[model samples]
Target: MKPALESSPGNPLAHLPFYYLDNFHRVLDWIGDRYADLLDGEEQAFLAGFPALPQPSRALFVRMVMRKGQLFRASKLQYDEIGCPRAAAAPLADAGWVVADPAVTLDELFDLLQKPEICRAFALPAGLKAARKDAQLEALRAAHDGARPFSGWFDGDAAYRIVAKPLCDRLRLIFFGNYHQDWTEFVLSDLGVYRFEKVEFADAARGFRTRRDIDEYLQLHACRERFGNGEHPADVLHDVPPPGTDNEWLKSRRDKLLFQLGQQFEKLRDWAGAHAVYRECGYPGARARAIRVLEKDERYGPAWELLQHALREPESEAERQHLLRMAPRLARHLGHPRTAAGRLAPPRRLDLALPQPDGDWWVEGVVRDHLCRDDAPVFYVENALINSLFGLLCWDAVFAAIPGAFFHPFHHGPADLHSADFHRRRADRFAACLAQLDDGSYVDTIRHNLVAKYGISSPFVYWNALDEDLLELALHCIPPAHLKHAFLRILQDVKANRAGFPDLIQFWPAERRYAMIEVKGPGDRLQDNQLRWIDYCARHDMPVTVCYLQWTQQ
Candidate 1:
């Protein structure tokens, strides 16, 4: 005898016989009642028939009903459309049941439906199934050039219907050649979703078509071949000319290509080759243009040569000015300034001078005073030496004028007094001066001093210092004028003696054989000669320092 049903609803069908007819009937009824809203009319009828059916038939019938409902929903159609009268009365009768909750708003759930297990369970209609199968076969045929006997099976009305539908363009392309004029025309004409129709066909037939008509057309019209042979059919016309006369665009493209080639040659450091190409283009302003490009590339030698040739020709004033401007830069590149040795006799003796605390006190005052009293201009005669000494001495004094200044002198020995001690001591003094003076008053004082002393209308002071570790750093800070002066000194020394100077006198420690240093106050930078000297010292294993002044908060 069967046991009485339990009151608990743990599992309503648990107590039912595992394979008994009565048990299967109860299970089916439980399912229908629990998911009444989910069941279609046919599924409900099948469940209701469970109690009367034989044990063997009940399980199979329930499975068939559930499977049919799933198939009806997945096909995006109602059971009525597929000839199932009972399923036609379901809750999802119009739109069909969404296997996963159709109303579920989460992206995760939507993604879950795309999984193989879920997608497999969701059955499509027979017609869609056949069409999808045909698409897969078409893709395979396009991918592999094999001639299978079953190929003809897809050739009739079924093939056209499947291919004609707005399916994936990639799949469609496999069915059509890249240059299929009809497909190309269709894709290009569409201003909407079907715009990719040709692209899809091209992508599918890419690499398969050997002798594409599109390529032939481009070749015949002197148009650049845009697509590679194995490229997709959709991509064939990607860079093709529009459907009209082609010379203008083609010519423009050619010119652009040549221009780009010239740029590429310039990039490769082939300035000559690039210049030649630019000349070949016959641009009216090609000569000046080529020279500019060469100059930018630091092809100074070639640029200078070209400029000389241009100057020899009878050019307009504008052209002459252009050449003149270029001349100075080229002159610099070629080290054109005639040195003292080249233009003037060497001095009787070289003088080493010490920096004085007072701006008016010259290092060798007696000698300077005597020369100043003479009819000759001593200032002009010793201008180079005076400038050098003044730069060294004023570095610290100028730095001290700035508040919170501290000097980091890059040198092998003790920090230069010009930068080190002066920077530390003068900073507070300068700040005090600045604090006492109003902004306008300070400006007026600077202006008056500039005009009275330097004979300049404007006076602005900027200084910086460099430490040994930061030599490269300090060199960058020096003004171009100062740098030029320093380089001139180095050049002067080199011209005087071919082996290079014994050591940069300004930075060299009197006691050490291989020590070099340069000191600058706040805002000051190393001169060019100083930089060259530092490089020379560095190459020769001499210890070097470039010290800069920094302002420390008191």
Candidate 2:
């Protein structure tokens, strides 16, 4: 079997394995059909001329473009897994794409792919001689121009040509792993196809339904000479196909796409077109976009009216909070007298007593020490053990239930469902995930994460945070319903509520009774989110105690 090149960072060309190479080559072919009009006369000539060449020759040129290197070994073509191999080197040589050198051999190719220190250990056995160099390879390395040692197309001194759209398209796909912003911007900007600032569109709303819809539509349309010149997505979006479903998730996608389209036009200083797109797609966030457009146009009255509407019913509490904070500034902009700021209603404090005077670290220790003699055994768990560690433990189950929950913007966690209503959309799946915590499967999931996923490096195993004793205590004492409720509560706002769980948990192993204790040192107060969680626990009849630490004078 070939060496695994999946995560080989040292050799950037490692991704040119048979599997990825196949799709990349195909996308390249599509690029010709997709963007032929964007090509200059010379590039069009290349496209017309490419298919006339032998398949082997095409393969070799494609490999050269894929490798993005001047020098390559002929033996690399011998790999049976690839489309073209050693038997097909003649076409590439005749075409002058490679200056295949005899010095570069299969041994050298393998050595290049392997680390320097380990190459010797994996070196080819003796008695195998490298095949003779083909004419293309020899001619390339031998070409000389302008008094240089070697100067061919591959030479650094050779006149640079604008890369054909298909080749550039292929390269972009290979590098970014998707044809999104990188490919779109590169093919349009680098190809000199669309000078965005000068480009104008007649029917900006005819062809696009979503961002990807606009991108693919433009990519396909912009290369045809008739449609290629100064095409506007805002013009053709109306002609886009109706969506298969009118669900909220799909609606949100259209909303986001419309917002993005507006932003792009605004960036181009096409305020009218931008405003039209925003109004056409008046989703939840679109009003905010409309306000900005009005403000940009110096229509303060309309902007203020739109701003008030946006503030009245934001998509989320967070958005409402943001709008509330932005209100005074918008009022000032419109020359309104400053309104007195209202104070927040203070949080009702929960009065719970700790056994002794303690500091931050001592609070948990003191709680544990007090609970040691109780009928229930107590454990002081760090924040991570309760939330992050537990989160990882149950990740697989939750992922199975609500796959979209894993979709994080940072690419930090996991999942990639592109819907604004992700949490709401996956409510059933989240409930399924909660079911896992409610059952006895929590032990299996935790063990799987620790032993199978992290092995020795698991924080639960390595950091002495989660032990067999605590696990046993939890299994014996913590009710599955309570655990399920806790998990469900956190899932409501995973990012915000995963932490702030009680520091100490006391459990009666025999009676299957457990209680959570949030330890607070002097001057410490419960955060709003934490208070919300506390209120949830109280309503749900889950045992929770707020242990305030009154420090003793030394």
Q: Cα RMSD (Å) per model? A: 30.2, 14.9
Query: Per-residue lDDT tens digits of candidate 1, residues 1-554?
Result: 11222222453444443323333344344444334444445555544543553333333322223222222222332222134323322322222222222222222222223333222333444443445443433433443453322213221111001111111122122222222322222212221212110111122112222223223333422322332233332343234433333322223333433444455566667776677656654222346657867887788888888888987972332344456667777778777873221111111123323233436643333333433322222221112332332233232233332221211111111112222133244445444434323332433443343333231111111112212222322222323334333333332332221222222222112221222234444465554334444554454444545534333444
Which stretches in model 1 have alpha-carbon errors above 4 Å? 1-256, 268-273, 284-289, 296-299, 308-328, 336-554
Per model, state how many residue pairs clash. Answer: 36, 22
How far does residue 128 in candidate 1 sit from its true spot (Å)?
Answer: 16
lDDT string for model 2 (355-385, tens) is: 4554655656875776665577777874644
Cα misplacement distance, residue 159 of candidate 1 (Å)? 9.8
lDDT of 2 at 539: 71
Q: Assess each prediction's global lDDT (C-alpha) against the native.
A: 0.35, 0.50
Top-TM-score structure, candidate number: 2
Please report how far candidate 1 places residue 16 from its true position, in Å. 77
Give me the overall lDDT of model 2. 0.50
lDDT of 2 at 350: 39
Model 1: how far residue 532 lies from native, Å: 39
